[model samples]
Target: MPDLDPPKRSRWTLWLVLLVCAAPVVASYFSFYVLDLRGRAYGDLIQPTRDLPASLALTDLKGAPVAAVSLHGQWLLTYVPDRACDEGCERMLFMQRQLREMLGKDRDRLDKLVLVPDDVNLTPAQIDALTAHGAPATVLRAPRAAIEGWLMAAPGHRMGEHLFLVDPMGRWMLRTPATPEPSAVKKDLERLMRANAGWDKPGR
Candidate 1:
């Protein structure tokens, strides 16, 4: 009987093929998650990844239609709530303002955005209150369905309980913990700005 053994050359070829197929994916993860990384990210990464739904559309407070794509190219700090401002909504607004202010010179690269779910209107008084608070937030009227697609409730939580972060590249990159401590969230934002320093600049 002839002795049988796996061919050395075939084993080498199989290993080479596996390495080639995996190299790009490995390199990309390294570049994004490890290489020269600087951000103090607070949100845990979802393994499968979640993103902003493309189908969702929103209108500004003025009724001007805006696409989710409009948020691209800026670090967006977003809050979702009904049009009628409540105490919780007020707190979110305040936190957003504080987070932006904490950025100091890098603040301009960030946008404070509020997405109002449903057709509920913002009364003049409500608008004035937000303005009076010195919060330069852009309030948009979004369909409830669209809003829900992006902002989710934790297992037993509600949408507005947490603040979400979007990167300059338009990815819903982070979700600060529910009722995150402002100081901690500020540090996370600052670290993100620092990490992307080479790419992101202060502007519209």
Candidate 2:
């Protein structure tokens, strides 16, 4: 009589493979939501996150329609300012560039979005500053009222004072303080990137 045992070896192999594939997703979830960091996010994580509106329309400085690439498929470091582009506005622009550059090899995974209120103008110098961040540095004209509803500012502050982090899924995930501390903001960015390593990659 031939031995008549179950195919335990094949069953074990299948289970092993499934575990390996699921490990990353489990780990990512734990790191992002379950793990208890000393003080939550370095930048205040927006409680009850908001989604980027699909119907909201934005145009470039010349009044041309903006591209979809700016709003989706990559993490966004966003700033909104009045047309004047004052000293504070210029500083925030520089901060956005600096923070993205600080991401180093992961920099390409991020995009900078400057929402131009219809009342505001994008000066030549401002345009030059944006160009320095490389391709797809988005500067677009959008309805101030509409955009404000999505990205909330720090209490007692205007929208321009804050820098926002939009997840690849088009959600407003985090908002840095009115006066950003680069080190603090960078900590928040690095943590998210590390946690999302399982699903997120350098490009898009």
Candidate 3:
């Protein structure tokens, strides 16, 4: 007669493999939902989470139709700048870039989306500034009406005053400070990446 059950060592090995495989998913959920993230992080969790609408018309830097996947496939740190990239606006833009870069090896999992009103175009100087910073030449633009309806701001703050944290599902989840310390923002992002490491990877 042959033994039907596996040996004890084999059973333990199987359990170990299962745990290793599931570690990422468990850690990710714990990092996001169960942890006391607010005490030490920069994210402001959005109540009644707002997801970006696919029907909303979007245009890319090339004046080409924007793909729906671009908005939702990766973790996004977004900002809305006025028509003119003033000194303050540039500073914010710089911060956004620097913060993403601070992610180091995990940087690819994050993206920068600058939302601009449809009625405005970037001046040559504005383009040059963004270019000098190695920013995408043709940034994405969305209708002002849509931005107002879709994104929420903190009390007494307008759309242009804060950075948005959108989840990979395209849901708007967090509202960051208008002017955040790069190191502080990096910490927040690192926590998020750690929490989601099991499920999230670099790239869309």
- Which candidate number maximizes lDDT? 2
> If scored against the real structure, what TM-score would every candidate get?
0.74, 0.81, 0.79
Tens-digit per-residue lDDT, 1-204, candidate 2 = 665356976788889999997787568746865573336777777656688888778887778887544577888899999548899998998899889989888888898888888877777877877866346477788888878778878878888888998878788868888888998888878887788788776656
Using TM-score, rank the candidates from best to worst: 2, 3, 1
Model 3: lDDT to the true structure: 0.76
Question: What does candidate 3's lDDT look like per residue over 61-174, in tens digits?
Answer: 667789656677788888887556677777887788888888888888888888787876667777666556653422687788887787876887666667888888888877
lDDT of each: 0.71, 0.79, 0.76
Clashes by residue pair, model 2: 83-120, 83-121
Across residues 1-204, which tens digit of lDDT does each residue of candidate 1 receive? 664356966888899999986675456444555653325356544333456666677777677888877777787898876446677767887788888988988988998877788766566776776556654677777788777776675676666777888766566757777777898788777666666666566755
Tell me how candidate 2 scores on lDDT: 0.79
Q: Which ten residues in a row have the lowest lDDT in candidate 1?
A: 36-45
Ranking by lDDT: 2, 3, 1
Clashing pairs in 3: 24-198, 28-195, 61-138
TM accuracy, model 2 = 0.81
